[model samples]
Target: MAKWDNMLSMLWMLRSGRKLTAAQIADSLEISVRTVYRYIDALCASGVPVVAESGHDGGIRILESFKETPLFFNSVELKALVDAFKFARGACYPYTEELESALKKVENGLHEEQRHDLSHQTSGMDVISPSRPPSVVPLLRELEQSAKEGRTVRIAYRKANVEQADEREVDPYGLAFDRNEWYAVAFCHQSQTLRTFRVDRISRLEPTEARFEKPERFSTSAYFRNQSEREREADGPLAVIRIEGEPDTLNALCGHWHLRHYLTERTDREARFLIDVPTMNKYLPMYLMTFGTAIRIREPLELKRRIQEMAYGIAKHYENDPD
Candidate 1:
């Protein structure tokens, strides 16, 4: 609440690899640019390596060594900060504790009013923890342990689509949960390839002493965005499809595959969209099948043909297998 604390906080934030202009800082702190300039002066005088650059892209930069430097935020500020980390934790189970610890420090620093405000704000935006069963928790715990230890483990898994099951030996790297499905990202010892294993579908897990190492450049975000149970893609470039349909029809396919939610949606009787698709592009074909009468594909003749073929095949199957 004090000017000195706010200045320290602002400097720490700027050091967190973010650049804030005087106007932006003033607006955020409900202060004037004149005060921000004073704070910047103090930081410079205090041996804080604050660099301000004048360009369209540059504003300020605190060199890398700034992490070892000092910054302060009271407990209330810290708990308030946990909001983003907790919001993002669904994809980064591996980083939630580090996020929580950072939040704890801020929480410990907050005064009573600040703490009350934070508690109210956090409660206002409640996120119910996913309904992970107790039995599964232990398995998840084991998977997490093995992942961190780079330990090989055997998992008995079932593929939902195939309605079949098998056992796999894998070198676990990390665990992630999306919606209701939990997945383990790991290297399959038998397949000698990286693959994702669904947690619930895992019938069994056996931790082994066989240890391994994660690849030096493994990125969980990249793996999550790229890997999912989807229609097999025919490789090349992202399949581009021109789709014309009502907004409702198109919205369902917005986030699918290489399909980007383009800014090109337009409506007459129908909305027109330019969608990028994965190589296989199942959504495009199946979608065309779903709205056989309502939607049309205006480009990519191969997709149009596939839609036609699918309809014909479905018609024939229904007629032949009238049971």
Candidate 2:
């Protein structure tokens, strides 16, 4: 098991409020007694306040202060947690039932005055989505189970822009949620390499009895970091767009949650963007049009030509409209 997983298991045991000794923890987790002690040291270093008592009858436990506080959250901590759940709920979280129940339990533990205060604080915040996406809860659960059990699953997957569904066997390593989407990062037997498949795109999933050992040093985070570096080095077409707008407008463009990763550089008077899309097709035109006259394509005459053509088409359509 990974050190992180081990730590989490230990934390859960301590959270149960039952006295657990290093020997008991090692036996349950099937790890060495020394490892249990090391994990305890790590927890203490990270401010967990895990108290260890020395003696034949003594054991380890979390500080009593945590037991009094619900999940060890103060009023401020409670507000932050509620705010996160609020955004996730508004975005149509897949596990809506679980989220609601958990939130209720947390609030139930609070005093009546605390609940009233939280209600006021939450009313001032909001997360708005045009439409709720379909729930990915079923798929999420299967993927999590497969990852934990080290089992291979046959998944019926639909690739983007492709209508046909293909079946493939994958060794699940971990699941990741990003940009309001969930993905399974796993070792693909079909592609003979690691690939990421969107959980929503998976139409059907069937877990198999076949199990595989996770690679010794494989990490989803490291894999993504290496993939990003490789993409940056790839030979791809680039477009330099000069942005001239107010400071706030420029900040808005840069600070957009989804667009922030693509931005390479910016300045006070102007900003330069490196476009990766090969063609100035529908996606590029539609995106650039959002900025209106505030942006100009500095290079790639092809892109400028396409935008001009699109602008002419729009003008023709609205030529006879009454103002």
Candidate 3:
């Protein structure tokens, strides 16, 4: 059971015609008056129309309009919430304490039968995200708060491979978590464009007083999809590049999100992938060399030529030439 069950009980108590003092609520709930005040703060934070009163003959009560409204979540809906929380808890997001606390409250609200159903759902499921540094938790919390309030945030961000951190002011849109990491999608004022920042790479964060309106069409899912499409297109027109390789090589390619989706055919011996390597002349050689001779490029004579040039360059490096 959640220690903050008093929040619910206090709300129910305030729903009656009589206004209740903090001391009265504390006495009824058998907790300290200070605890009652904390529950009231929490209720207000959650958007409850709780009004506080002071002086003699004064107390607290919820708005009259809220009393008659009955809100409920069915078992399936509750289970969905539990599952989501379960996944999030495992995601490498900072500030999981609040999420765990909220999950506990949700669990405490469930009936025994519904809880049994939730238990069954939770028993066999697990999510595993790579570990993150403890320092990033505060930054994540600030970013989340800014996103919720539509406020701006300033941060010193460094890319994983970059040596210098850049100061940026951003309008936080939303956050995303994958199996490997957490990301914040934001519109950057410095770049005059939107960018994604790895949460762990953010070295410093501060919420600013400036607020911004979120674009109507902006969504994390859509943004990522479009970003990916642009990258694939930027490399030039899509080409059908077929490779003959061992099964492990195909499995390795399938591990990549873009490559996996475009994988048209797969067999124990080989796999065919249609991809756009726009910078083929620059990167194709390096990429092919990664798999060594285990793979062979079967199409697009252009890529084959580039690969040969790369191999020739490597061969030349070992040759003894007199100037």
Candidate 4:
């Protein structure tokens, strides 16, 4: 009969200064008056301060100030909350213990009927992410707090492939969880240059009394737009080239953030992209085959010649010719 469960529900319902008679409680609990009285005794025995007045105008009332009472849920709400946690479990952030503890409270609070529906046959779901050694979630939290409060912070940051960590004085602007990686974008005090530092590689944060002003136009979205290296590639010259490829591959390639602002096509087999590209990185002939015989590079003869020479070099790699 979920005796204790029903009594707890009754206490909560009466907590709002609303009186509930034995008959109403009994009907809601699908039990008899005799059982209701016994449950009321159970609550009082547990020091819940449940008061029941007798006679024609008697009812049940619990002393106020009870705030942590378990919530009442039907089957639908229970199912919805379960689904919510199932999805959160996929995010795979560092809240494992906390999330499970919160879920347990929900588990213990469910009414008997709803509990059955929740525990009934359902497919178990899981999230897949490469658990690359633990990273500092706490630092990200502190970084966010500092940025939001307009405070300055210090961090020992080591760039990728560097030998040592350097003390960086940064005025925090904002953090981004882009494509599953966390980036802290801010102004570097040492270099007097703006930079984006990866969150995982950051170690040790110290908050200081020094206050720093965030740039007025430092919108995170706008900052992200300028992160590409293509625009900064020497400013040597801009070139447009057309190539042909299958539609789906072209579609996926075109949508890449680096390519999106620069690509277009006249037909499924043919497309064009303009890149603010540098010179030394080109290996021409090999790059041309990327279109798989259906596409051709139509501009900048130097780029096309580079492609042809690279193809010859590659052919020489497998040929019997000594030259």
Note the Cα lDDT for every prediction shown: 0.69, 0.76, 0.76, 0.70
Residue pairs in collision within model 4: 244-295, 284-306, 284-307, 285-307
User: Model 3, residue 5: displacement in angstroms?
Assistant: 33
The list of candidate 4 runs beyond 4 A from truth reads 1-127, 132-135, 229-231, 240-272, 277-309, 321-323
Tens-digit per-residue lDDT, 1-323, candidate 3? 24445566777788886889888888998999988888777677556788988988789989887744233455667667767776776674565677778878777755567679778866776676666788777777888889889999989999777899999899999887643677899999999999999998998888888999888877887777667666664656777777788888868866665555456788887777676677444545687777878888887888878888888998899788765
For residues 1-323, write the lDDT of model 4, one tens digit per residue. Answer: 56556877777667878778988888987889998888777666445677888887777887776554545555656666676666555544445558778878877755455567787722454456545435556777788889988888999998899969989789889987665567889888998978888887787789988888888877865677666543554666667766556787666556555655555455686667666657224422444556455546566676667777777787888898755
**Model 1, residue 248: C-alpha shift (Å):** 7.6
lDDT by residue for model 1 over 44-148, one digit each (tens)?
755678887898987766776765554545454555576677665643354567778876776665556766867776775645465544456567778888877
lDDT of 2 by residue, 1-323 (tens): 77767888888888998889889999999999999999887666556789989897789999877643224345667788888887776655657678878888888866567789888877888877546335467777788888888999999999999999999999989877666667789889999988999887898989988999888877776665566545553456766656667777788777654355556788875666665655334356777777788776665676778788889999999999999
* Local lDDT at 93 for model 1: 50
lDDT of the structure predicted as candidate 2: 0.76
Q: Which order, best to worst by TM-score?
A: 2, 1, 3, 4
How many Å off is the CA of 251 in candidate 1?
5.4
Q: In model 2, which runs have C-alpha deviations exceeding 4 angstroms?
A: 1-75, 91-96, 130-135, 216-222, 233-323
Clashes of 1: 13
TM-score of each: 0.53, 0.54, 0.53, 0.52
Give the Cα error of residue 305 in candidate 2, in Å.
Answer: 18
